[model samples]
Target chain A: MLHELQSGFMAAVLTGSQTELTSVTPKIREGKLNTAQRVAIYRRNVQSTLRGALGDIFPTTRWMLGDDKFLNVGDQFILHAPSTSGDLNQFGRSFPEFLSAMQPSAAADMAALDWAWHEAFHAAEQAALDLSRLGAVPAEQHAALVFQLHPSARLIGSAYPLLELWQAHQNSEEAPLEISKILPADHHFLAVHRDDANVTLTPLSAPQFHFLKICAEHQPLGEAAEAAFALDANFALQAFLIQTVQQNIVIDFNEPS
Target chain B: MSPHHQSSRPPHALDPLCAGIGLRPPHYQALLGKPAAVGFLEIHSENFFGAGGPPRRYLDKFREDYAISAHGVGLSLGSADRLNPAHLENLKKLIDWLQPSLVSDHLCWVGVNGRYLNDLLPIPYTEESLKHVASHIRQTQDYLSRQMLVENVSSYLEFADSTIPEWDFLREVAQQTGCGILLDVNNIYVNSINHGFDAMQYLDAMQGADIGEIHLAGFQDTGEILIDTHGAAVSDAVWALYASAINRFGAIPTLIEWDTDIPTLDVLLAEAEKANVMLEQASFAMPTREGRRHAT
Candidate 1:
């Protein structure tokens, strides 16, 4: 009865197909409304509830899609994804992935950035690696020292300027997003991280993203710098390391741990 | 840490005599600037389930000055596919960290077979179903290592196959599991209008020692049936029932829940004030309603 009752209602609500309602429809009394109307109430609630979740998680995506298309995309996603968590915040983890196929232009880029922000918001807190802590280490150990990114660190790359698009949503002075104005080759490497205290998204050059990404992968300082230099021989590893530590992106480091 | 809790945070006591309002995001700035003149604060537990951030920060700040109640919106306790271990783990983590005065979720299941609806779906009130839900409640209590309350959800429709009334199902769950009842007065009123059951009878059936917390929230009248929106002011009918519920249960800890379309903090405080006044009136208005044993 549990499988029969829940699956039927879920199918009816998620797909708007009445075929599955046969098992539970007769159980509902039609005093003021018929079976369809009664089920319609739940149908509407489920849609609005799930759609509202996606809206909260991806406000930038909502700004891009407006009310109608965002909802339509959400409706289709809800049917396929079927939020597995009881937590509403955890419902749309796969929505950004689903947006890749969305019509009226896919929001894959913006959704990716928003998903990064969403994850960073809930990521665990850890103390940032202090440069002074590294100062005590012998200069010879610098390359072997493994600098780690914060637990919430995420490096997102996009062909479109998603960081710009997402940042534009925050400013009151910027013109409303015109997707048409967005160029495909506007390559962006955005560093999204939640330090123990704050969450931020900052643009980085390709070399910078790769360097930090390699460092985030637990690569030693030397290897990470070499990888960044591979993109461009003149990559400023010292300046990048100083700025990252200041931003608390490069938190703790270990000596061959 | 004790088996009842996994975290090292100490337990905080909640004053059952004081009525509080749901602390929402809209009210955070004001409340954080200066703690509101209310008894305590109530928040949707899931809202603070995040690992860290402003929700985490604000909740910690609020806990400094006020007692907190974690009213969970998810959990889907009655889901036939067994209690979600992840959801339970998150909840226990929160309880361990926050050490809230009280914790509660719904009597209805949110999803089944591993797919969550995220909405409180109605469950059939039958002997078999009753046993199923009760077992989940018992399991939850054991895992959480403390007694928690189960709330009665507002449903627009009822199943014809239900052999028992919702009130009986709720009461039986309390009796069988020893979990407290968070009797939602507005839900009873809304359910009465929608399903044509007597709200007072629902209230009367809930007169027990297990009745611990009371929730008062607004609902929308959808022309055909009432919807528990919790976005408006508590209706006159629900207040009247609160008066009755107070006489029946006696000055239980009441919470004003405003989830959506949240008005200003003043409006919410005013609603809390109203509940406080009714609570005051109930203290002296009528004799103790018999058969109502409150778990102090």
Candidate 2:
């Protein structure tokens, strides 16, 4: 009886659906205090709490859409998707996908990119790249150096001017944002990494994106070089490795066979 | 190392009689240089789950000065799915890093069916639910290699199939498993009022020795239903219950918890000072021949 009442109570709280709390020791009547009024408190709490979590996770998306529209969208997300972890940081893992299917928006792809950036920011940390280990590789292998991006590094490809959208929405005071006259363009590559304890994004060339993606898979330099070459044969492996190592994005490296 | 050698003796903090307050962000800067009189500080473990940040930085410094407790909200231990190894791993890391005096989580499931309610929903006090929660707590203790406390949450409704009283279910869970009780006094008061039970009766049913800590917080009364909002000042009713809890349990390390509309640092410290006074009065006062003295 305890299980039935509590489960029914939660169901009513979660969906605002009517549930009779029978089998309780005193048998609670829905009409005892007007079931709708009784259940409204929990429903308000659940929705408000979830909306606050979504606001934290998708601040950029919220900024792109005005507060009222964003809340409207939030209500839809809450009704359609239920959070799977008590951690609010994990609340929006599916939000990018949700954006992909939501009602038409001029900046839908940009919203997806922003959500991805938030994920990378809170990702687990890794030790910086060890230069001593790289020294152990033969001096002859320097030209073929392939480096591993930290587990937190992510690559986002989007067709909208997401970088501009993200830049305008930053907590900093910038010139007024003008998304008016913008249209979706060809897919652009973006490199997202946590540096100085803050997640940052930089535009990447096709070759640069593929190269990091390959190295991120722990592929050795030689194989990763071939993949990079497929995109742009003129890809400079040495220069790329130097830049990546300096950025603290590359944490470890392996020899290519 | 052998299992015996690997296991460190349970951490030693203040005696259970001490009263403390939750250290929140608003209080962080002020607490840094000030002298702390409270017994300990309890923080939500998930608030510091991420890598290095201000929360970790402040907690590290604070732990050095005060006994600390890591109270968790996201373990979801009672779910049908296996305990989340990742969540446990993060908790273990925090435990190792901070070396808190006590660790605890709710006695209810917040996530299931691939959806997390992100709120503590009550468990049916049936043998089946008990077994599931007990095994999960046992496994969590083994993995963390420490005895953790499980807290009873405020629930809006009771389950129909529950076979035992809520207090008995809680006490038995502690007895059957070696896990301790967090014993949130405010929750007891809230549940008692919501369910039409005597709060003192619930306290009497608990094993005082098994309680590792106590929690005091404020709740919002919506007339029709009381919500454990953790906002505003501790109500007179909850304070009365706190006095009762301290009398029965002999001052188990109490905590003043305020999470929403968090007031100024001075305001929180003032609240903590009030709890300290109550603890002192409860300890010094003699138990009358007619049971405990009702505080004036």
What do the candidate models score in CA lDDT, each in turn?
0.81, 0.74
Each model's Cα RMSD: 3.3, 5.1
Candidate 1 wrong stretches, greater than 4 Å: A102-106, A173-177, A195-197, B1-10, B285-296
lDDT of 2 by residue, A24-114 (tens): 3243334335445545655787788889988877877777776787798788778787886667667767766776786434456666676
Error of 2 at A78 (Å): 2.9
Collision pairs in model 1: A129-A251, B4-B145, B209-B293
Model 1's alpha-carbon lDDT is 0.81
DockQ of all models, two decimals each: 0.55, 0.30
Model 1 reaches what TM-score against the true structure? Answer: 0.94
What's the C-alpha lDDT at position A69 in model 2? 72
Regions of model 2 farther than 4 Å from truth? A1-12, A18-38, A103-107, A130-136, A142-146, A171-181, A226-237, B1-12, B15-18, B23-30, B33-38, B51-58, B77-82, B286-296
